[model samples]
Target: MKNIETTLRNVGTVSLVGAGPGDPELLTIKAVKAIAAATVLLVDDLVSPAIVALAPPGARVIHVGKRGGCKSTPQAFIEKLMVMAAREGETVVRLKGGDPFIFGRGGEEVEHLRAQGITVQVINGITAGLAGITSLGAPLTHREHAHGVLFITGHVRPGDSDTDWRAIAATARDARLTLVIYMGVRGSAHIQEELLTGLPASTPVAVIQHVSLPDQRHALTSLGQLHSTIERDQLTSPCVIVVGDVVRGVAAARAPEALRRIA
Candidate 1:
């Protein structure tokens, strides 16, 4: 009777996989394998269709869009779906864009999944901050220019206090840290103002959009000109904002031949 009871209950695992940026080729081997084996996949809004095709034809794909400043699937509902799918013995893959831990709300998902007693795994991928900066022929940390880096998010939900950009600017200036801000386009005006309190108005800044994708575009300017640069170039969200001396000289970095450099 115990044997029969044990056999009657089937259990499955959940893998929280990062799809990297938009490039399908950037997916890790493990991520690819997990994706292919998924009987149920909950994909984020930004995941590339090309990567989604790695899954077999029979696998179920559910889009749970989560773009900033846009209507998105409720986080609670997405968590509930994960728990439901895993309990049904489906090989569940919660595919997110970029490294799951880097402002991807991956930590929240992991805690919720574990609380529900679902076995979970996480696979790392190159985050947009890293990829975006590199695409400009620049490095986040340079011995002479920057000693450390900070990856921050610019979005502040209603009722949430705004970030202390003045404080961050002071620290970044004194500590030689490079600032990589995500979802920051909307607040560029305010951020530029506060950052100028510590960082020089002439400090270098670059905004890179759709990093790692074919249509990627970036604008290089100074801290004082951040808002103007974005306005002039029509830069939008789903982008990263880089600031500090590390961006001072990227015009000579080796980039794809076709990429156009703008200021």
Candidate 2:
């Protein structure tokens, strides 16, 4: 090992890496490189264990759980830990699930680190909403079905104002867009009701759980039955909820197989 003073002076770098949607193979080559070079890793709860295991055997791994609606390690604390580790001249990696910029709080971490003059690099990974829908063979945006796609978080921060779902539903309906909601299972009923005011009750909806994993499961339902389907299927957190005409493609694609079996 290098001398402590030399190590401290040479080290001090932080990489904010996206671990992707629960698949180790989905990790970007740059992300893997950052992991391999890390002397300290600050891992988020949603990051897959397989990716975490890629860290060097001697790297210190710290779990900074940030799951929604659960007791979480405070963001400020996590930021402090990163600063501390990096300032000590250790190569640090803040591993988060999905693209750090997309609802991953990666921006905040980057801001905090930069404020303290720490050098930080970002490595992008596939987000769950994108990966989840594709896993079902549905495109997020199709020229014939959807004009665009919107990604939103289902949970509102505590003490903050709630999202105007009614307005969003109207916009989505008018824009012919696909809606992908993350961290939405708990408030699914309310979301379904508000969306119904704008979207047709027959609009296709898909709830994908454990997306891209070996045990992944999904359910297809209409807007009217979205809540009921989730409850009946016992779908829980870490699921992606997709709504809009893009889902029709999933049904249409499966129809041929279904008809063949029937025949």
Candidate 3:
């Protein structure tokens, strides 16, 4: 671990560390050092508790977590917590699951902190796209098969928002590009319906649940049956949805029995 000397000013600094996808080894060295040196730690629901245990002793670990279908701490409150801690001249580390910048709302926290004259550091981690793809032995970009790749979130509303999954799906489908969708587990059916407006029904899709963790499971199905397969398999959160020809390769190599863990 690198020596992290958090020089505290009148307004202290916040280090945003990405915890990666349920695997501590995937954490960057900077993230490890930030945790070891933090005086205050704020964590999200997606972050594993084991990762939190790695923080230095006597560090204040606050669970300002937000998750689907659960009571979550408001974004404003989380920012206020960081601001208050920093104002006290404490070195705060805001830890998030996966890459802080990738759909983790780390940007919002940074903007809020900067507005208050607090310095922030962002350490990127292994996002679910890379981890899920690697777990399935599928590459997002392949010279012969796919020239480009697209990463989108299933939770984003279509059109005019900060991010648009529908538009990206249309463009990527038209170009036959690989697509990776994060947090698309519950919305798998809706995503399938929307994506079919752009891509063929036969387009291959893979739903990987609990990727890179023990008891990981995946279903390789067509764009048309993707949602049904997910429901039949009883796949849950912490899953990654992939749509493209690359899924066909995964289907061929991955045994059918391997996907039959649950329902």
* Candidates in order: C-alpha RMSD to true structure: 3.0, 3.7, 5.3
Residue-wise lDDT of candidate 1 within 1-263, one digit each (tens)? 99666643766789999999889888999999999999999999888888889998999999999998789999999999999998888999999999999988999999999988889999998899999988888899999999999999898778999899989999999999999999999989998999999988878788999989999998888888899989999998789999987776575464533223333
Candidate 1: pairs in clash: none
lDDT of residue 2 for candidate 1: 90
85-140 in candidate 2: lDDT tens per residue?
A: 98888999999999999999999999999998899999999999999989888899
Task: Give the distance in Å from residue 8's predicted Cα in candidate 3 to where it truly belongs.
Answer: 8.0
Q: List the residue pairs that clash in candidate 2.
A: 12-89
For candidate 1, the lDDT comes to: 0.89
lDDT of 3 by residue, 62-102 (tens): 99878765688988999999999998888999999889999
Better of 2 and 3 by TM-score: 2
True lDDT of residue 239, candidate 3: 87
Off by over 4 Å in 3: 1-10, 157-166, 255-263
lDDT of 2: 0.90
RMSD of 1: 3.0
Model 2, position 149: C-alpha lDDT score: 95
Best by lDDT: 2
Error of 3 at 190 (Å): 1.9
Off by over 4 Å in 2: 1-11, 256-263
Model 3, position 243: C-alpha lDDT score: 83
Superior by lDDT: candidate 1 or candidate 2: 2
